[model samples]
Target: MRPLAPSFAALACLALFSAPALAHFQEVIPSADVLPEGGEVNIDMVFTHPFEGGPVMEMKKPVKMGVFKAGTTTDLLPRIKQSEIDGKTTWSLETELVEPGASIFYVEPQPYWEPAEGKYIIHYAKVVVDNYASGEGWDELVGLPVEIQPLTRPTGLWAGNVFSGVVLKEGNPVPFAEIEVEFINDASITAPNDAFITQVIKADANGTFTYAMPRAGWWGFAALVEGDEPMSSPEGKDVPVELGALMWVKTTDMSGK
Candidate 1:
């Protein structure tokens, strides 16, 4: 009898990418960041296949990374909990049966980042994320409440949504405020979602407003201009506006409240 060898595609995928490049029980990449106080963290994990020669291969596969509030069995917020961990800050999602590729994780900003940002720590271990050509993989987990607690301070936000905010001009709320936002994947700039953005929203009669949001990404407030003019608020001129999809901007003094 003859022993089986390997194929070009099989070898190309490499076992490392399929397994998060982590050891039998160790972390490969531990990331952290500076976050606002009292914010939640939403983690986004992406998988890529690295090659021995040439560049790393990007694989768009069905991988799940879930988060559970310190202690509970309820469905995690992002509900991608394919990996099970010991406590709140400890977890390992699997890319099992993966075709030898790499994975990326982005812990989005909440109201703050102290929870899992630079303060907490994470260890890596591989788990199996099953896949089926048929769509029967749905958990049918439904709305069963399992009593999950919110992390005193969690990390990550909606994967690619933008947080809306407003500025004012001459003691008046600026309607057509132009803002710049950058979409990022892990550390790379993702394809922009400007096409999905809506027109400027207005403040209510009370000088208050609710803003719209784009999916989720690394966002930076570019400018606050209305119809080609920059806006000014009593607080000061254009200030640094960095918001995640779950944050809100307050324009109090300019609203004449």
Candidate 2:
């Protein structure tokens, strides 16, 4: 029994070190994924480890922020309000819906310097809200440097439904791209291990991937790839830039009558 205990301790140490690295996600969650009829939506912008739900990183004013609807894009940067999440800088925005259609909100954040990784990260994050039961144009592409065009309608989804998307970079499909998926822990779900915290999947040769939502909540999918060129870090050394195509989708529970 004594020898077994020591052997178990050694295995635990190895498990801790051998687990795959956890991935970070840029969250653009809204107060509601579906806009009420003629109502407003509150949006929260933050850079964080979503599943772990702590150590929120500082996010600067976005390089670009806007809403796309009915084939026109409106700049909403001035409406964004700044606040702190866990003492780290965060942002929010509010917008009212005037018509029935799809509303796509996007943010191109300034390149965030990650000291631990010795690189810069720029995750172009976006979320879609269906307005008044009209699912119009939920799949519109905003022409981001990297983006996920949802094959599945991003809003008004139900738990256990499968969500699918194509990972695109510069309007071209990225074959077999690596994607990381995590759900916001607002429900306080405890992960049994590190692997349960962040789920990973890969796009197929055509840059498409699918994930089934096991629970009703907000889920983020981030397709990650390296940029073509390096950028200068704050310390004046050139560092690799990681471009992430991130999207947030919400799912609901089936109503019990």
Model 1: how far residue 244 lies from native, Å: 19
For model 1, residues 1-257, the per-residue Cα lDDT tens digits are: 88788887887677534543210111112222212221223333322111111122222222223322212222233544333232223232322222211112222211111221122111121111112212222122111111111111112334323233333333344444343322222433332442322233444443333333343323222232222232333345532222211111111122232
Total colliding residue pairs, candidate 1: 27
lDDT of 2: 0.90
Clash totals in order: 27, 0
Q: Candidate 2 on 1-257: residue-level lDDT in tens?
A: 54545678789888877866657788898888777675889999999988888669899999999998888999999989999977889999988988998889999999998886889999999999888868789999988999999999998889999999999999999999999999988746999887798899999999999999999888999999999999998899999999999999988889820
**Candidate 1 regions off by >4 Å?**
1-156, 160-162, 185-216, 226-257
Q: Estimate each model's TM-score.
A: 0.21, 0.91
RMSD, each candidate, Å?
22.3, 3.8
Distance from true location, Cα of 205 in model 1, Å = 9.3
Assess candidate 1 and give its lDDT: 0.26
Model 2 clashing residue pairs (backbone): none
